[model samples]
Target: MSEVAFRLFAERGFDNTTVEQIAAAAGLSRTTFFRYFGTKEELVLGRVGEFGREIADALAARPAGERPWEALRRAFDVIAEPRPGETGAPMDIIRLLSDACALMTRQWEKTQGWQSMLVPEISRRLGGPGPATDMRAGALVAAAISCLDAATDAWTAGGGVVSLADLTDQAMGVLREPGDVPG
Candidate 1:
């Protein structure tokens, strides 16, 4: 159903596409579509709601001794790129989402919604939860997510030629000084 909707969204603008059209194209009744997705947006952003849990799990799975920033980067790897052995995503979805301002905004909004899911794990890595630790963990998670968004923006603009993980690394690296000198 999502695949059919995505194709329709690609062919027609997201604003122009309707749930009825998606249902018809998918060969499913409107009731069936509603049963699966409450709104047209869900067809696109469904996976995003759980992104925090996914990211947290990925971060937690990293080596225990890994630095927080490195673990964050490694964690984003799962979200940053297509899974191994899968064909690369068709540019149509990227184009579809990029062209829609409402969708772009909503997508980022959804990303923000997941930040809390990552904080506890991040706090754990920062040596357990407390005001100071949680404060720092929250900041780091926000920064990491922002960097990931920037990398994704660049990827969409560049036609996704560069690997997203590399782009994310590049994005995150911009915040750091090249040499280890006394600040």
Candidate 2:
């Protein structure tokens, strides 16, 4: 259903594509579509809830010795990295979602949702939450998100010539000093 809707969204604009069209494309009734997705936006942003949990779990499981940036990068990679034998599908979904400004905004909004959850967790991992700890957590989360967004944009623009994981590593590397490489 999501793939069908994504194809329709790619062919037609996101705003121009309607739930009826998505339902028809999927060969499902409007009622069934509503049963699965309450709104068209859900077709794009729905995975956030599921993936968000995975990301949070990954973050929580990171070694306490890891730097916040490295920890966050690994957490993102947990969700973003494709499984074996699956290469282009994840990138295809990202590119399709990127084609729409609305979806892009939703992506950021979802990231913010993650940020909200991560800040306190990261703070706890850093010791405890306070002005300084909270700020550090917030800054790390924001920077990691920026890197992910930039990497995703580059991957989409470059037609995925570069591996997404490499791009992600490079983007996260930008957080470190020129002489410093993140492990």
Instruction: Compute each candidate's TM-score over C-alphas.
Output: 0.82, 0.79
Ten-residue stretch with the least lDDT total in model 2? 84-93
lDDT of 1 at 158: 90
**Candidate 2: tens digits of C-alpha lDDT, residues 6-80:** 677777878899999999989999999999988988777766655667778888899988866778889887556
Predicted structure with the largest TM-score when compared to the true one: 1
Question: In candidate 1, what are the lDDT values of residues 1-183, reduced to their tens digit?
Answer: 877787777678789999999999989999999999999987777656655567878888999887777788899876775765422142344456688887778777888976777777778777856524577778878888989889888998898899777899999887645542111
Q: How many residue pairs clash in each candidate?
A: 0, 0
